[model samples]
Target: MTDPLQDPRFLQDPYPAYARLRDAAPVQRVRTGSDGLHSYLVTGYAEARAAFTDPRLSKDTARFFAGRPSGRELHPAVSQTMLASDPPRHTRLRRLVTKAFTRGSVERLRPYIQEVTDGLLDGWAPGGEADLVEDLAAPLPVTVICQLLGVPEADRAAVRGWSDDLFASGEPARTDAASHALAGYLAWLVAAKRSTPDGSLLHDLVRARDGEDRLTEDELLSLAVLLLVAGHETTTHFIGNAALALLQDPGSLARLLDEPEAFAGALDELLRFDSPVGIATFRYSTEALTLGGTPIPAGVPVLISPGAANRDPVRFAGPDGLDLGRDAGAHLAFGHGIHRCLGAPLARAEGEIALRTLFTRFPRLRLAAPEQEPVRRRTRLMRGLRSLPVTW
Candidate 1:
């Protein structure tokens, strides 16, 4: 049991840990010393998928935290997201907003996504070479999400700042500050939508709230915040990771560039090769149970590693190899079963368009510093390059 977070081995390539854990102990108990945090790590694809769909494994931590010393309930604002609840609450809320996340709904915005992507590309100085991350990856998705959620285009910068803060799990003080800022901003937006409804996802959610009795006001606010933050953050990393994967593999990148119609298969491989959300959100135990021969006590927290599952040898042949033509629809990058990410289609479209357009625009693009491996974010929950410096 090493300090998984600080262990460089886990950082550089977690596949070894996943390989060992999957083979020897798919479910292993881990203790957090004095923090009083005890949990299980589910590493295998089948076991992880089962846990994902198990009604006994609750996504809502509120029940588990009851009478506990955790300060989670101290901030009612943060604990009120659909991701933190189970059915019928989770089912109801997800259904109410399903229209905004459908494949058809997201595809309708493809033309707009292209326009947004191309607009950002137009702004970049090709030969001068800019950080593909900042110049393109970050802005394109932010713009699309802002426009979709009805956030005023002028407020994109501020919204992005808040999102960065809320998802910053590394520093305690920073995470708290970001949480407050993001929550405050979302509260303001939710109130505005109530008074003046416009045609956007936020507006549709607000209207749905009036039309249905399933979601409460707080639940609606939390859902809105989740949609905005999760919507952009996950896709942001996907764009960066996917581009890095394709660039690192010349054969795959060249094929996609040579045949523009190959975006679909290439996108799947990119997702499987380097997932953006490296970890599943959180699920708690409902009752004591033995999983993969490891005993998990009731009410304990568990973190499922999706990135590891994507590379599971049992599930993928040459799991580490980049095969653009392989069938990758079974990849767990989007989690399996009912709780799968609602924004999958939107993310796929954005990733495909951004990656294709990026390479097409600058075929000679190369890392600004070839000697250094790109630094990744410290959070175990998400995988993203801290900064990607590039030149044409």
Candidate 2:
């Protein structure tokens, strides 16, 4: 009975555990702390993919909690978003902003992204180390996304704070409070954009419509908040985790440095080797479904562990090793089926460019702190170092 939540082994390296689970049983009923809700954790590659695309699986927490007086309430704004909805509305909402993340759209922002990365690197004094998470990884996405959203540069810090408070916390109560604050902040931004829309993603979304269909006030705020949080936090981790991986494997770093173009392949490998969003956004069961030979009764909560599946030996040849040139496209790090991450292309571009800039500029970069002392978060949803102290 491995307690997945508090397992120290899982906290460090979960590959062995995932292999065991994948081999022993496609589905395992993990015991929960008495207080936590009972749920199914999908680990097998095939089963996980099936669970991801299953129509019987629901993302709307409201339907799962219907008539249940569990003192827990899903945030209305969050629950109403496309991420939490099924077809029709989901297709409509997703189509509204899909054009904003096309190849051309993301590529156009590369120069601006490079400038942001360089500005942050320039601020780091020679031989004077700082937390890479703070000085670079954390701020780069903030600047890039803020500019893309047409958010006033002055509001960047405030928006970042709101996003962090909203998503970084593990506790449900705290997350709810942060969600409230985030919703309010987004509402304010919508009003501000009303009077002064500019050439940015947010403004484009404001003007976006399908014939006569347009986003409602709540939909607008919800989508903006989703982009703000999703745009930065995931990219922050991608940059930090990929950099940390390269630092740990100097050979990989050197390879990437020599052939910057190798980033497309290497980035995929890094993502497959160690993903940031360990689990997909929470999925709830709509009907009694058999997953991995286990009966998942209707209304049970489900989480597909992409981190676990990415390292599953059944999926990767050398699952535990970091192969910079591996064909890592099959990994579910960006998820599978219809709900795959919409910002994935942008994230991949940002990661490739950011990693290239990092290694190329600071050729001698190494961890300032001892390897064992590196900071890591205890969060179950997103796996990342809290702070990565490094010096050139």
Candidate 3:
């Protein structure tokens, strides 16, 4: 069976294929890799929501990879973050990390976010062409995350480079190398924070507490790596994807530019219409179970498609169109369950500010190559554009 998820055409625009998959069943079994293994994708909104919290599907990476030799030795930072852990430990990590990574922390970043956006836009002149991905979309979040996390100015470019390589798909060697490099860098950052305490979020995280239960060395290191990698990569693409959608829809762009406040609600629709995280990270079934009424044997790998589920016609009216007016709050752009992205509020704040500000300033913004298809990156887990060249 062909893996629709990896097809180049499907990557360009996946909604049509997703609709067909949803029509076939709420859940679809498909070939996910070249290794001849099969995985279940919960594509319907309801099933996807359920699968997120299903106790039968364990997110523990050690449990999933036990005895499965792949010749890759992942760093603890790569293998043991909140994304890869389940319960009790997940609870503790989230609790401690949350103490430092608060919504208030995100709110404090708003002024700086605006400043960065303005600075990036300044690089391009009015009535000129620019790659939105490079000029505004990519740099905004990367700069903002480094600011929010208190990463030093000296290491910002290196940090961003490592994150880009870490998330670059289909390059296992580079990916593994990035994993160790980032993990090692973060380990040093953590140690530096301990000896010379600073006022940054990373320092706070190093000193984060939960009734005297501190994050162990591994937990702290992994969480830092997670925040650094997960923090900026998807978001760079998210701003790109959202900005591209608006460029293609002048009417929608006008609505946002005309009324800045409208973006607060419209961001959800944008997220659902073109999810940043196309598919939730993989998890393996802890035991045999029935999901969306489909039975699966114990230990089968599973994936949840936010891209497919968020656009199911039954759940969303005219799922293909971009409707900022629709109540899109129920969308699963951020996975539902305890493992939901911790950086979600921050991402929303950044997205709303990024999109609203970009169009508001560049009122005549448009695609540079309207006749050619947009180039999407080659990764199913995170759907984003490679570059969104535009002119105003």
Best by TM-score: 3
Please write out the lDDT profile of model 2 over residues 1-392, one tens digit for every residue: 44666676675666677677778876766654446556688888888888889999988765666788866444677656778878877888889878555778988888988888888888988877888899988999888888888888887897788677655544677667777877877788778777787777887888889889999888888798788888888888888888888898989888888887777778889998889987678788878989888888887788888988888777788778899878888888888888898888878878887888877888899998654756666666677777998987
Best by lDDT: 3
Error of 3 at 353 (Å): 1.0
True-structure lDDT of candidate 3: 0.85
User: What lDDT does each candidate get?
Assistant: 0.80, 0.80, 0.85
lDDT of 3 by residue, 206-225 (tens): 88988889888988888898
Instruction: Estimate the Cα RMSD of every predicted model relative to the unseen true structure.
Output: 1.9, 1.8, 1.3
In order of appearance, the predictions have TM-scores of 0.95, 0.94, 0.97
The lDDT of model 2 is 0.80
